[model samples]
Target: MNLVSVQDLIEAGRQVSLTGSALAEQAKKGTPKQREYLYGLLVAGVEGLEGFRLFFRPFPRGSRA
Candidate 1:
């Protein structure tokens, strides 16, 4: 598994926006229908983070990174 820093993710998002993400700006007149896919990903990420932060008990010190 690869670990990604928040800063890296932010930079990637900026690049995606600047480049006009395909799913978000491919149509001729308006936004693409799949634009909302980004929102779904954000929602899922938030929920998953919440679970990892709140639902699990802490591991013993020096367990896993």
Candidate 2:
């Protein structure tokens, strides 16, 4: 597996955050199509981040109970 470096992860986070912020701005303008696209991007970004976190961190504690 290709390991992601800290810098790579940071850059990805920054890009996703910026995209989400732009999407929010578009959403505030009430453009339905833009809003939909923005929502999709936001969801993908969130899922990508969650996957990254899961890959780097240990499983949640107390889950085995």
Candidate 3:
């Protein structure tokens, strides 16, 4: 079993947050092809968030109980 440190998790969360921000920026004026690319990224981000959830204890507070 691989162990992840708190710092690693924080970095991953930051990266995902950045991805979401970029997605929003692109969505505002992106072409169809660009939007499709953003959709793929959004799906990947969701999967990443799910993976983070598994590592967390007590469900991480604010997120859906």
Candidate 4:
């Protein structure tokens, strides 16, 4: 499993105007739409990080650079 830092989640929350534990709470108890929105934000944020780019890449066999 890929582990996401709390900092990244907080940043994603900031992008949506959420602050502090608000995002983490919503992630745990929010409606499906809210969870999905958070998921998207987290994924985008993680994918944007240089260290995580490789984990998100989908390369065919022998095609990875």
Give the alpha carbon lDDT tens digit for every residue of 1-65 in model 4.
Answer: 34444555677667545685977765566655656666677667655674566777678898756
Q: In model 3, which regions exceed 4 Å deviation? A: 1-28, 58-65
- The RMSD of every model to the true structure, in order and in angstroms, is 11.1, 13.2, 14.2, 9.6
Give the least accurate 10-residue stretch of model 3, judged by summed lDDT: 1-10
lDDT of 2 at 56: 84
Candidate 3, residue 53: CA error in Å? 0.8
Q: How far off is residue 27 in model 2, in Å?
A: 1.3
- C-alpha RMSD (angstroms) for model 1: 11.1
Error of 3 at 23 (Å): 6.5
Which portions of model 2 show Cα errors greater than 4 Å?
1-25, 58-65
lDDT of 1 by residue, 1-65 (tens): 23433333344445334343442343223333333444445456666767777878787898994
Please report, as a residue range, the 10-residue window in candidate 4 with the lowest summed lDDT: 1-10
Q: Clashing residue pairs, candidate 2?
A: none
- Pick by lDDT: 3 or 4, better one: 4
Better of 1 and 4 by lDDT: 4
